[model samples]
Target: MAPRDGTPDATGAHQRTPGARELNAAARVFALLADPTRLHLVWLLSRAESDVSALAETVGAARPAVSQHLAKLRLGGLVESRKEGRRVVYSLPDGHMKRLVVEAISHADHQVTGEPWHD
Candidate 1:
């Protein structure tokens, strides 16, 4: 088969060589943020770096629960952890994280609030 321009009709859909590391990194980041608690955690951290206790209170969850979320975030590289005395503070790994959460929430707000989307 051939395209109108005489190129192969394959449509450039051939599977390119996979970049496993890059794809895995993205997947891991998303997986870490997949939890409802983690999403809220990111929002809180976007407001400012916070410790597990504060985050647990803000999210209305147990400190252990928040710790689980933080562990995932730390492993996925979506967040960084530090020690302030005996407390562990967590923050976005970089500026892009803040922008990502803000833009995503804004997009969701606009989408849900749009007239076309309203019931």
Candidate 2:
């Protein structure tokens, strides 16, 4: 198995190929992000941390639905949450997830607007 970019090593050996477990885990992440509501929640979180109430209002979803989506994202390891007094504030675990969400949205914007993609 070659790298995802399919670049061959000079020595002709597989370099850092993704294992089945890693692929499955990544698939789970993508699956969780497949939902529009979850993607919106993640995009919002990418901007800043917020509680469920604010997320619900911003995304025009009910609190329970937003909570459920947050729970799924938390379980999927795409987001993390911590209690702030009576509220559970949610955020992306690291900068990588934020970059991933931002890039995904940018790609979608290009696709929707028929904009030229740049390298």
What's the number of clashes in each of the models?
A: 0, 0
Looking at candidate 1, the ten consecutive residues that score lowest on lDDT are 6-15
TM-score of each: 0.74, 0.86
Q: Which has the greatest lDDT? A: 2
Cα RMSD, model 1: 8.3
Q: For candidate 2, list the clashing residue pairs, or say none.
A: none
For candidate 2, what is the TM-score?
0.86
Candidate 1 C-alpha lDDT tens digits along 1-119: 44354243464432444478758876776777777789899988988999999899989999998899898788878889999999899998787788778866776787888834433
Candidate 1 lDDT at 119 equals: 30
Give the per-residue lDDT of model 2 (tens digit) for 38-95.
Answer: 9999999999999999999999999999999999899888999999999999999987
Alpha carbon lDDT at 103, candidate 1: 66
Top TM-score prediction, candidate number: 2
CA lDDT, every model vs. true structure:
0.80, 0.90
Which residues of candidate 2, in runs, are more than 4 Å off? Answer: 1-15
